[model samples]
Target: MTATASSPAIIRGATLQPRPWANGLGISHNIAQHGDGACGFGWMIATAELSGDAAFSHYPGIDRVFTIIEGQGATLTLEGSGPLRCRPFVPAGFPGDQATHCTMDGIPGRAFNLMLDRAGWRGSVTAQSLAAGHRMSLRATAIHCLAGQLAIGEDVLEAGDTMLPADNVTVAAQGAAAMALVVEVAARVG
Candidate 1:
């Protein structure tokens, strides 16, 4: 009954509507909203048509980290850190309300998002491309395939395969065009 890295987590179809943002800042959120702040432990999602030009903003209740899923180039100017050039597959963490902006050098695509509630849980995320039989060195509490195709053991995850960790064991992907999203969550009780 346990979910594994080789299986599809939750396959979410593309949405028809858009989320709120400044003009020309259209985006779509594929988030699981069941736990805290529209998420189990937190919110996990992907965003489309994000501002590629240092389009920084703030969320009132969620601390967020973003991964540049696809695009030519982009940069993030944080409130208390150095400028982050949005590189594909690179995960960057920031304060929920920290002021920021982004600029890109190419077209925009789906950018993955992982948000944690400021008052409760803690989490981190990353996106990596794995060739058939290739593996990742990072270990965490959970991981999911957000895009592309993937296979772990006997299961095949096409786009949304989610898996729970096994004693912090390392999970790997074994197929072309294999990309996975890793998240580690621990509840923070106040």
Candidate 2:
């Protein structure tokens, strides 16, 4: 099933289906189904305890960006590089195909993850908020707000709101108290 939307053009929202991998290290699924204009991108919200002992190999075709949402604290090591301590709300990424490990001292937290094939697509997730009446006119990719309230168009979207932003994607916020995220998905051009 797909839900379609328009800000001028038609957009759609597909349900995030469940896909279990890594022997249940975690669970994930595509929020969007098959192509209906919006394609070549992957989004997964992760809810799991951090572990380095799991021993993860490189993801051959996927490029991933991870943003911590809730947790104590964790460290991510990229092969030769030393561990980078990660806190809640911070986002980071590297070649998914590279040897990577995540370790936590005590408990695990939640994180948002977006993974796309390095060749056909690319994407990013941020923990910042948008101000009311403030329009970001960046022309690179599509925009979607997964959390927070956005004074978009004329409505205040409270989490799980979205938009496909290219050039000319403009909106006037209703109030200054509004805040949200602008996730851009862009096509990789050779």
Q: Among these predicted structures, which one has the highest TM-score?
A: 1
Query: For residue 38, what is the lDDT in candidate 2?
Result: 27
TM-score of 2: 0.64
Q: What's the true lDDT of residue 56 in model 2?
A: 45
| Runs off by more than 4 Å, candidate 2 | 1-18, 33-58, 131-147, 154-156, 161-179
Instruction: Write model 1 residue lDDT over 1-190, tens digit each, in one string.
Output: 1335444334334432467553345665554432655324455444556654546546656778777766765777877888877677778777767677776767865566677776777777866678767765656554567666655445455564455544444445655557787777667776
Listed in order, each prediction's TM-score against the native is 0.69, 0.64
Instruction: Single out the weakest 10-residue window by summed lDDT for candidate 2.
Output: 32-41
Residue 3 displacement in candidate 2 (angstroms): 9.8
Count of backbone collisions in candidate 2 = 1
How does each model score on lDDT? Answer: 0.61, 0.52
